[model samples]
Target: MFVRNILSAIIISVAPVSSVLAAGGDTPPIPSQDWSFSGPFGTYDKAALQRGYKIYREVCASCHSMKRVRFRNLEALGYNEDQIKAIAAEYSVEDGPNEDGDMFERAALPSDAFISPFPNDNAAKAANGGAFPPDLSLMTKARANGSNYVHALMTGYKDKLPHGVELSDGQYWNTYFTGNKIAMAPPLMDESISYEDGTIETLDQYAKDISHFLTWAADPYMEERKRTGFKVILFLLIFAGVMYGVKRRIWSNIH
Candidate 1:
């Protein structure tokens, strides 16, 4: 009877703590999805990467800058040099001092980093109602479960808020965002952009493509690294086998 009372007391003590933890946690769990680049020996889907780049260019680029990625980096998505040059020519970049010490604007070069929509952080915040749009260059690595979070955030907008939750002005509800309130509004819609490769243009599709692209941006050499690792492992296995054979031959007479 004493042991039963003690166990009941422990359960009573733990119940409120568990309830508090469950209720107080704000960030919703993100569901994992299969990706072409997910596992060992996995590689990126080229077509998805291309479509992702197109989506980023049309949608996310307006707010988020990929400062680490150069126009030339598009070659990794299967764009030829001429196509990259043409794409770079579409934007104007600031360049400097042609005998006159003044900065001048010229067409963006293949080597130029992606142009930012806002000139500076303060300007970006001012334009975005005091919310700074983060650069997406390393965003996939910046967040835990990064790809899943990106995909969830892109598709998590809801028309109605949950009960007892009040959002301040300029804040939007996102089911997957931390605290369930995000500053950015829904950025995608059904058939928002046409795909030349005949892929469906749903919001989920857009989210997946952009997530894949961001993953590649975070680790462009992931495939190369995996390939090199595999080769090293194979070489080590073969060398180990040869060493074992030589050891057996050397000790055969002694035993």
Candidate 2:
């Protein structure tokens, strides 16, 4: 009976692994990246985050909306109040009901979240061949190995189609995307945008920078969380040591 129970447990554990492998058999492994904000002590690289923001602004902003992030949050990327305001003012956003109870368009403020490029979902789909682009605010947290997946998807476009694979109109081949077909065309190219900071402008670099930025967006308080965790661990260790000494004193007296 014990042997049968042990076999059943082993089979249960192995079944999930088999199902996972079967479900993702067609998907290629996402290559890992060495992000600055990866480990327990990891912190976001401000320069990379700024560059990533620029890439998103110039390239990805046409389709993707990062509605969870406000223009004021650019302060974390080292932007001052004036710079943030200037950035915010570049975009027009919809604002409230006047005395006439009608919505009005106005220049965006620092407090305003990044606005969607399209007014509504139907409009977005109409613009993109009936495919709605996903919002990017929490993309890093929404996917498994989110940073690596983002980097892979960005750089994984292929010019030539694989044998036995054909793409429909408005679809492109991506080596890393599931089922190997994606709606979005290649978004990044070498030297597409010049950098103020003199970083080389390449597709791979763009992917990395954007991945880093998105990760930071997904978890802006990672550094604070890690710091707090370290403090808690240190306090626990000290308390444990003190308790051990007190127990030793009590036992010593008893003995």
Candidate 3:
């Protein structure tokens, strides 16, 4: 009778705790995406990278900065020296003192790092309602799911909020964001930007493109690294086969 009463008490105590735990873990799982640069053999699609650059320049650049990336880095995306020079020249960069001790702004050079959108962090936060827009240079590498998370985040904004959830002012609902509320508004929409390459301008395409580009931004040497690794593996295999043949010939008379 004592054991039965204790068991009943334990069950009663744990049931509500389990229920609360289940209710607290209600955020939806992020869906995995098929990225061109996912696996060991994967390589970035050049056209997609270019499109992604366009999207970043036209839309995302206003809020985000690619501080670690420079204009010359665009060469990896197939931009020639002249093209890169022209593109860099389009933006003004801060330069120092021509014979004097004052700083001035000048046309950006290919060697220059990307110019930030805001003057400083505090200014950025003030402009965006106290949320500091993070630099995109290493954003993909910084996040857990990297490209998948970015793609999901861009596409996760929903028009309808789920039942029982209330959003505070200045907060928007995003299915993939923690707590389903984010400070960022829906960034992409259908037909938001016209692509010069005639690729269909859809939210998914933009998300995928930017994700791919950000992946490249995060690790620009990925293709070269993969190529080098493949070569090393091939060489090792050949070396092993040659050694095995040599061993067999040397041991043939003995065995």
Candidate 4:
């Protein structure tokens, strides 16, 4: 009976103090981030990313710009000269000489940077309501969760929220997005890409693939890094084994 009264009194005292201390209300949780395929500041799958490249080319190229990526960068992602040439030819670049024996706005070649859909900052901001659609060449690196954020944003879009999170009037849920609310409407759906191979188009798979591909585009040397890391681990294991054997042999003499 005495313990119960003490506990009740403690609870009553703590409740009021807790309420007063938390006058600003609770903070929202940081969005959970997925790092299933990340590596350092620059990493991911080459082949999957290559496929993602194809998706970007066939779909995303219409609105977004990968201004840092050149047509030749596709070759690093696994394309041949003919493919690169064909892709490069699809876009026209402007170039001309000036009075100072220099050139500007020269016609784009395979080596040129991917062109922004809007010509300049003023035009881009004017069109996008002050939100310059960012050059995606390294967006994965710039943002947290890197590519998964993109995947989530692309896949995110439903009429509801899972729970706890209150949806704003225009809010949409993305499975991969941090906080599950995103601005871009779902960009991919199953069969969004028409592959002659008849690969079943599932929205989930496309989002995953394209996100992975962008990861690759942002960093094409992932395979090389993985192979090198494997070699390093092997070398360390072998070195550790040899040192252990030497220690045992030295102890045997002392014993």
Clashes found in each candidate (C-alpha, N, C closer than 3 A): 0, 0, 0, 11
Per-candidate TM-scores read 0.93, 0.88, 0.89, 0.67
How far off is residue 103 in model 1, in Å?
A: 1.1
* Residue range 1-255, candidate 2, lDDT tens digits: 999999999999999888855554266789998988878899999999999999999889999999899999999999999999999999998788988999999999999999888888888889999888899999999999999999999999988876656678999889888777788989998888789998999989999999999999999999999999999999999999999999998899674
lDDT of 2: 0.90
Name the 10 consecutive residues with the lowest summed lDDT in model 3.
Answer: 20-29
The alpha-carbon deviation from the true structure for residue 132 of candidate 3, after best TM-score superposition, in angstroms, is 1.1
lDDT of 4 by residue, 1-255 (tens): 999999999999899768743542222322433544554434454456666777887777655788878788777766799888887887787765678866665445788888668777678667644545667778778887666667656655666644455656544565555445554556677777865545457876677777777776676667678878889999999999999999999899784
Q: Which ten residues in a row have the lowest lDDT in candidate 2?
A: 19-28
Off by over 4 Å in 2: 1-25
- RMSD, one per candidate, in order: 1.9, 5.2, 3.2, 6.0
* Residue 101 in candidate 4, Cα distance off native in Å: 6.0
Which residue pairs collide in model 1, if any?
Answer: none
Off by over 4 Å in 3: 1-26
Candidate that scores best on TM-score: 1
Better of 1 and 2 by TM-score: 1
